[model samples]
Target: MQEAIIRGAEFDRLDMDRVPQFLTRLVTRLCVDEARHNAIVKKMASHPRLIPHSADDLVDVVCDNAEAQWLAARLEAFSPKDRKLVLMLTSGFTRKEIAEELGTTPQGTHSALYRIRKKMVERYG
Candidate 1:
């Protein structure tokens, strides 16, 4: 852990409140990707232990890498409108409020969000 910090792992900077959900998403992705799941399983198998501390460490490293890659892909794939929509959504704006701010109808905002989700699923899944 000290080595990780010296290498700037920055796990301490993460919001503890979001860690569970973040790990849940990472685990879900691992389940979907057979190659990654197999690799993780093989690593765990090779280091079998009653406590499995090494597996836990492996999970932490993998989760951090996966989350960084996922976010990078999301940013790369986002259109300008998609970026704006995400920004608005993150700024505590409701869809209706965002639509108003963007000079669009609420229905339009909903449609945009649906399209964004579809694109992300196609790109990432």
Candidate 2:
């Protein structure tokens, strides 16, 4: 409910009469997406990992070494909470999902993201 209104603030205008329906749809969509995300996460957790035997299968190793490690070093320099937030965002958590996980409002989540991006640009760029 609160999340919907926070998200709604992004729109310049909405049909005054349909506002309830609009918020209902927005919440419903978020619920559906969250359910799907949970199911996918569960499925992946139960899936087996395949061992890399060929060069192609090892591309991830090369890529991770080249970029992931570099970004990881910078991410490590953040405060524990900020580092966790960055990891959550990278792992496909929605703003609302992150807010729920962090026990914060969506507006706070958005503000944190903005601050994180600014710090990254200013300190790392």
Model 2, 40-90: lDDT tens digits are 888877777743333322454354234434454688678989878766765
Each model's C-alpha lDDT? 0.65, 0.71
At residue 44, what lDDT does model 1 achieve? 76
Model 2 CA deviation exceeding 4 Å by range? 1-73
TM agreement with the true structure for every prediction: 0.41, 0.42
Worst 10 residues of 1 by lDDT: 50-59
Candidate 1, residue 105: CA error in Å? 0.8
Off by over 4 Å in 1: 1-73
- Give the CA lDDT, 0 to 100, for residue 108 in model 2: 92
Model 1 lDDT tens row, 8-104: 4466576778768866876777678978878888887887473344322455445534543444456655777777776666554666677888899
Instruction: Find the candidate with the highest lDDT and give its number.
Output: 2
TM-score winner: 2
